[model samples]
Structures are given as structure tokens and as C-alpha cells.
Target: MSELIIGVLGLQGAVSEHIKQIEATHCKGIIVKKPEQLHDIDGLILPGGESTTMRKLIDRYGFLEPLKQFSLQQKPIFGTCAGMVLVAKDLTDSDDVHLKLMDVRVKRNAFGRQKESFEATLQIKGFESPYTAVFIRAPYIETAGDQVAVLATYENKIVAAKQDHILVSAFHPELTSDTRFMKLFVDMVKKSKEIAAY
Candidate 1:
């Protein structure tokens, strides 16, 4: 099979880090700066960053509708940290939602400010061992729809989840050296491409 191409929303956040991880999985990673670039990738990674600022850039770059359409196509999306907030259908603190693609209610900065950032070992679902997770001004899922499968939690708060092609995590997987989290997303993309071929 040909190598999969994954894109990192380059408007903001850990774009290079995600690119590195995507390449680590033996896939091509591109920084998607325009709406039309979405058509070239089999999957996308919304990296960690300031959700509000990223939203502004998304609108400025005219990516809002294209991003929504990308999700509608059932191409896999992995949202990390602020990216998770962007994809959520609802926010505990605000009525405004960006993508509204994921069926979850998220609370921004649920873990406190940047100085409060810390790391924790998480027992993610489907993984055989604990994964070290880094949380920096993160958001946690307060509620998820029936279709959402809760993947992992920290302090009893939902930190990771998957609903069909949308995968999200409150922590930044790119911050850690472990590629397991990224591998999971890669697998999701592989499965999606396989299904689309038929």
C-alpha cells in the first residue's frame, strides 16, 4: 500500500511536533495552511494550542467550512488538547463552538493555568500499559454522546475519547516521546482509507 499522508493544521500549535510523530509512523506529514490542502491528506491532526486564537486564524484563513466538510467526509481527525476543545460540540464555559464535530461537552483549562501543567501516567483503553500524558492548560470532557467511546481518564475526568472517525485527547501526545497515541491515530487513518477504497 502507498504511504498515508497526514496533515497538521498549521495555523497554530505544535505543528512540527505532530509532523515529527507522523513521520515516525512512516507516514508523510504536511502542514495544511489552506482549505484546499485538505484534499491531499488521508487524515489530519489538530495539535495543541490556544483554541480562541486558533479559531480566529481558522476564520481568517477561511478554513471553517472546509474543516467541517473534511469531517463530514469521514476522514479521521485526531484532536489534542486545545484541538479537542475546537472539535467539541459544546463548551462548559461558552456557547460558541468551533468545529462542533465531536459529540462532547468540554471544559477549557479544566486542569488550571500553564504553571499548573503536569504529567500523569494514563491507562488508555486498548493499550496494554500505562501511557505518560502531558497536560498543559488542558480541557476535559464533561459529557459525551452515546456514540462516543471514552478512551481514558485522569482524576476521573474524561481525557481521551473516540467517536467514529473523530479521536480526541485532553493531553498533548506530541509532547511525549511515546508514539503509541500517534500510532493509534495512524491506525485509524489506515482503516478509514481501507474503507474508502471499497
Candidate 2:
């Protein structure tokens, strides 16, 4: 298989950390600041950041439509932290939704404020063991549609899930050295590329 190229949305958030994790998966990581850059990558990551601010940047750069088109192309997309909020189809208290690519309803800052941030080991679905999840004013999935597969939960609140090529986690997986989560996305990209080639 050829080396996969993964782009991290660089509008705002933990861009560098996600880049590092993508590289750890033996894939080329590029910062996607423009909509055109989306065409050069096989997969994309929406890292953790302030959703409102990120949304402003995304709109400012004309990325909203292009991003939705990217997902429509069946290219793998992994959203973490505030990225989870970006991809969710519904918001608990607000009608404003960014990508609306994932079939989940999310509640922003469901975990509380910044001072309430902490880490916990999570037993994610399909993983052999627990994965350390870092939550910093994270959001949780209030409800998921039939197509969404719940991956992990904390305090009975959905924290991780996947639907086809779209994956989301409410915690900062890039903050940890563990590359399993990133690797999983890489594999998804590879499979997507393979299917496209055929």
C-alpha cells in the first residue's frame, strides 16, 4: 500500500499534536488551511479547539462547503474534542452546527469548565484494552442515530463513536503518546483509498 496523506484542519486547535500523531502512524501529515488542500489528502482530522472560534475561521476561509463535500466523497474524517462538536448533526442548546456530517447530537462542555479537566482510562470498542482519554471542557454525545456506532462512554455519556468514514472522540487523543486512535484513522484512510482505486 502507498503512504497515506492526512490533513489536519489548521484553522484553530491542537494542530501540531495531531500532526505528530499522524506522523507516528507512518503517514504524511499536512496542515490544511485552504479548501484546495483537502483534495491532496486521503483523510482529514478536526482537532480540539474552541468550536465557535473555529467555526468563524472556517467560514472566513470558505471551508464549510468544501469540508461537507470532502465527507460526501467518502474520505475518512476523524474529529476530536471540539472537532466532535464540529461534526455532530445536532447541538443540545444551540441550532448552529458546523459540519453536520456525523449522525450524533452533542452537548458542548458537557464535562464542565477548564478547571474540571482530567484524564481517565477508557475501554473503547474494538480496542484490546483501555485507552487514556483526556477531557478538557469536553462535549458528550447526547444521542446518536441508528447509523452511529458508540465506541466509548464516560459516566454513561457517549464520548467516542464512528459512522462509516466519520469518527469522533470527545477527548484529546493527541495529548497522549498513544497512537492507537490515530492509527485507527490511518487504517480507515487506507481502506478508503483502496476502495477508490478499484
Candidate 3:
């Protein structure tokens, strides 16, 4: 209804970069720091950050309830890195608690620590350019349920996946100038609109 208000959950890392990338698509982006900020958004972009810390903020701000409610609305959501972890269906083995929105399991810092952070040119499915993905203390998606569709892979592991209207990328697509993945997500928003119009 409202003109495409996409929110970036801003409690932790890479918040600004998500906002910048979302703006590039010409969609109005809002910073969602509290539960009250979740209203009226057409979609949400959860940025790469410390999953543990972000979880604490969600609990502290009393946003866990409203945020989950918003997500269940089936509004398009694009989550990267820690965002991917947050959206996962389960974090049973991990120490960090997550919102568990996506039906997958992710291990935090599965690649390496800060010093092990590296960049790779990924051949993402359904994209033109070989996307330059930045993985900084990133999480690795271990298992994707049947509902999850693998979008990209690295080292024979599932790195990007989409389940229903939710898209999750294990690497930081926002850190780079590459807008391909971001554009893909924006397209999801447009698709959501089209589906609703019918």
C-alpha cells in the first residue's frame, strides 16, 4: 500500500551499507531500530552483522514479536551474512539464538574469523556479472530444507538461497558496489506487488 518502504534492521553491523544499496534501487529505505519502526514497510532487508548482538537488541527492544509478525506477512526479505543466520529455521547447534525465519541451518563464522575474511568472485545463478561477494567473519549455511532453493554456492556449499518470498545470502552482497544481488531482491519486491495486484 505505502510506496515500498523497505527497512534495514539497524541494531548491529553493516546497517548503513544495506541502506545505501537499497537506495541505489530507488526504493525508500527506513532504519528499523525498534519495534515501532516495523510498520507499513513493503519489505525488509536484514543486514550482515553480529547475530548474537542483534538478537539481544531484538529482545531488549521488545521487537521479537512484532518483527516476526511483520516477516510472516510474506513481505519480501533479503538477508545477508548474519542476516542469513537470523532468518534461518534453526540454530540448534550454534551458541547464538536467532529469529529463525528461513528454513535453514547456518554456522556462525563457519568460514573463518576476522583475519580469515576474504573476497571471492561468485558465479551466482540468475545473475549477469560474476558477483563479488565479501565474506567477513561470515556464517556458512550448512543445511537447506526442501523449501529452500539454492541460489549460489561456494566451495561446494550453499551460500545463497531463497525460500518462498525470503531471500538469504551467506555473504555480504551490500559491502561491494555490485548491485546485482540487491537488484534481484528489489525485483522480488516488484514481483510481490504484481502478485498482490492480481
Can you list the residue pairs that collide in candidate 2?
A: none
> What's each prediction's TM-score?
0.98, 0.98, 0.92
Give one digit per residue, the lDDT tens place, for model 1 in 88-198.
999999988999998999999998765359899999999999999998988999999999999999989999999999999999899889999999999999999999999
lDDT of 3 by residue, 47-159 (tens): 88788788888788898888788778777888888788888877746655567788888877887655358888888888876888888887777888998889888898788
lDDT digits (tens) for residues 1-198 of candidate 2? 778999999999999999999999889999999999998999999999999999999999999999999999999999998999999999997999889998899999897675358998999988998999999889999999999999999999999999999999999989999888888888899999999999
- lDDT of the candidates, in the order given: 0.95, 0.93, 0.82
In model 3, the runs with Cα more than 4 Å from the true position are none
Quick one: ranking by lDDT, best first? Answer: 1, 2, 3
- TM-score computed on alpha carbons, candidate 1: 0.98
**For each candidate, C-alpha RMSD in Å?**
1.0, 1.0, 1.8
